[model samples]
Target: MITDTIEKLVAKATQLVHLFNYCELCEQPIYQQVALCDHCVSLIPRFQLDSLSGDLLNRPEIYGLYSKCVFDHLIAISPYQYPMSDWLKQFKYLGRWQYQRLCCRVLNFHLNELLKLSDFCPPDIVMPVPIHINRWQHRGFNQTLPLARTVAKVFKVHCNADCLVRQNQTGSQAQASGQLRRKQLKNNFALLPNETSYETSNEVTGKRVKLEGMHVALVDDVVTTGATVSEISRLLKAANVAKVSVYCLALSL
Candidate 1:
């Protein structure tokens, strides 16, 4: 009995040690709640509002930068550069779930700041860019789902993973040019039949009308050439969603 008890205790201790958080970049101990150490967090490249400085309304370039191609707004935490690129590869291909926490912490901070800007309202619901069934099965996880869930929880909004579905296994867009990527992504997403309406109370005057006038935030791990967001946003617009905003961990420059 004593031997069994000791073994059980050792197992529990091993589990606890594994649960302790460490920075993926520096491999240094960090707060249990966050995946990144303070120094590593500071090292991650960030986007600045100044880079977006221009008359957004009159300047097509400025408008296109943030609000174009069917989405009303874009919120990206970092540029797809250096350490972020390496980190994302590990997170997605290697199944580093801890990286999700790191992503959420940074995203939450930026999202909150963006919400403070004029005319920016928190989205009614959050959705992840869906992966094809075959790819999902092979990977054993849809990487964007965790990001969507975390963002939804931070904003107190609902996350509906089933709202959109990828109909075919479109291969990687990594090498495709912008025009080619757009062509490849066409007609790839379809809304689930049962999730057409937003649920709400009478005080909120909720009505079943194919996402009628509802704002949606789409979450993704990265944005490259924006083919994914563009195609998905096109589908959401067709459904009459009032607005679509994209939130991504990184944006390819």
Candidate 2:
């Protein structure tokens, strides 16, 4: 009980700090909870949008970066560069939690813009690409999970983290070649039995949620070779998921 109280207090304190926060980059007082000011947010480079379909992958340059594609759609905030690269490094490696909020806010902003398009279709369900349990223990959290929840909240869909499991851990793909990534990630991911249901907290339950023929959004922090999400997409397709949309923070090329 004491621990819970202390956590609550810390959370409340964090909220208050955000409520009166300054922009981390510009040093301007920010009235809202966002870590960056509006100007800084606008200054972040965007992945060019498809003029017709609103899918980033529909653009030739972005599409050509991947060796092969399995997911039907790709939505991303920016190309992996500059401020985004720096922020992601902090959030994923240095454990700076504030950058997570910054990334989520940027993603939410872009997703809202995409929703304005007439042809855009949101997924029925969303999930983050799973990290191995060993990595989870070392990292203490899967960075993509919060981003997945952000997408789910924006789309008003259930965020189900329990459905997919990463069966193995591979070496850093940041500097690895596409073929090597594909080789290492081969058969690295597996899905849990579809009968399992997850609570909002992602705890497992007896209540079954059907995934057959459902559209799924797979969220990830970055997509370099597309090997990881592609492998995961193959598993989802085998399970009869009708469509898999990839949502990511950045595309590395």
Candidate 3:
């Protein structure tokens, strides 16, 4: 009990430090409850959670960054090809936060098609697949995190960035088969031990993580073959998260 209290204090202190260090890029007060500014906040495309079903879901695409372009309950948006294509270079790599908002808005816009079916549901919490510690240390940020956090905030649900964490370093997935890629990423995450217990908190994925069933919405910046999300989803299922629905800003075409 004492240790948990101390950890919470430390986490709060760190968050405060980050908050103070964060300057309003536009001098607009930076009042985002998540990490976005008002400009980014206003740009998110409105989406209906119930519109993802179609012929595409039934037939599922077979290749090119998307083996299954559409899920019976999943809809995705990718403005351009990935691995830092021009569009992604501008929005994801160049800190063009507005484009992040636009991408998410588009994802939301297409949600109606998937949700029309009953088997799918929006994730209870939005969790970005965490970066390897080494890369996160080098890059200074996980490019996908801000957008994922923003998506969670929009739905007024909890975002569990810490619940599932990445521990191993890895090579990029640019030139691998889908099955080989998933094997490469297998066993990459485990439930984190430091935060508040899922049981006591008023968080999303409301089911108990270590003990009972949970349903989660896994978020990512872009998914290429989905090896990363599938690996983590497997880990979460081992930890007993009942359902793992995925959401992404873009799907490489």
Candidate 4:
């Protein structure tokens, strides 16, 4: 590939910006399309499986299944090997939403990968998994929604942050066995009793529901246990979502 003068200048400028923003974990510079710090990048896992079914149906957390990955879309890319040890800071404490946008933007380059995963081209809706009202209230925002919105802007699909919501008071699925995890979430998800048409906002309040299905791409900030994705799949299935694909910025592996 020939590097033209303007293109070279733009690339150099990008590298400079990233050098200043070098990954906190590895202390090395980050560059365009780079998904992880060197150390974090080295931690990426390779879990051998007889099939994806174990991760999907029974022991998904081992694969960080979270029910949010498989059965959604043939997920193309992920940069999930991050280790943000500050339990409070990484998720809820230090306001990490700003840095999260880069993940979505990085994904813009992976649109071709996402498209190739499906026999069909692009999907109709880019849906971020919804956080509960209480969680949203406590955290003051939904992290994945912003990323999904940017992805929608790039991909030109309708970004529907309102369709699938995390119901209130659901216990965290941080570390649990598949059976225990499922039990913890018994009857936790519910579809709001209302309309999910194109004109609607695709949200669910205590008394309302929004989101219809043609083809949906489930978006999330991270996937650890397949349980979350599986749970999401069950709900979308009930809602008549035609094909559920997943597009996430990070994966536990």
Per-candidate TM-score against the hidden true structure: 0.78, 0.85, 0.62, 0.62
Residues 1-253 of candidate 4 have per-residue lDDT tens digits of: 3569889999999878866656545657666444445455334332221233212233444334443333644453443553322322364455765345335444554553344443344667777777778988888888777767866766676776655555657656666776786676655666555435445234532433235457777776666555566677678777787777665555554
lDDT (tens digit, per residue) of candidate 1 on 124-172: 8899999999999999999899889878877787788988999988788
Better model by lDDT: candidate 1 vs candidate 2: 2
Range of the 10 consecutive residues with the lowest summed lDDT in candidate 4: 46-55
Q: Which predicted model would earn the best TM-score?
A: 2
- Per-residue alpha-carbon lDDT of candidate 3 for residues 132-249, written as tens digits (9 for 90 to 100): 8897777667777766776676554567677667778876766787788767777776777654144324544455544236557778776667778777776766666677667776
lDDT digits (tens) for residues 45-137 of candidate 2: 986564746687777777777537788888878989988998899999988999999998888877887888788898989989999998889
Better by lDDT, candidate 4 or 2: 2
Reference-based lDDT, residue 14, model 3: 83
Worst 10 residues of 1 by lDDT: 49-58
Worst 10 residues of 2 by lDDT: 195-204
TM-score, model 1 to reference = 0.78
RMSD of 4: 8.5
1 or 3, which is superior by lDDT?
1
Q: Enumerate clash totals for all models, in the order shown.
A: 0, 0, 16, 20
Clashing pairs in 1: none
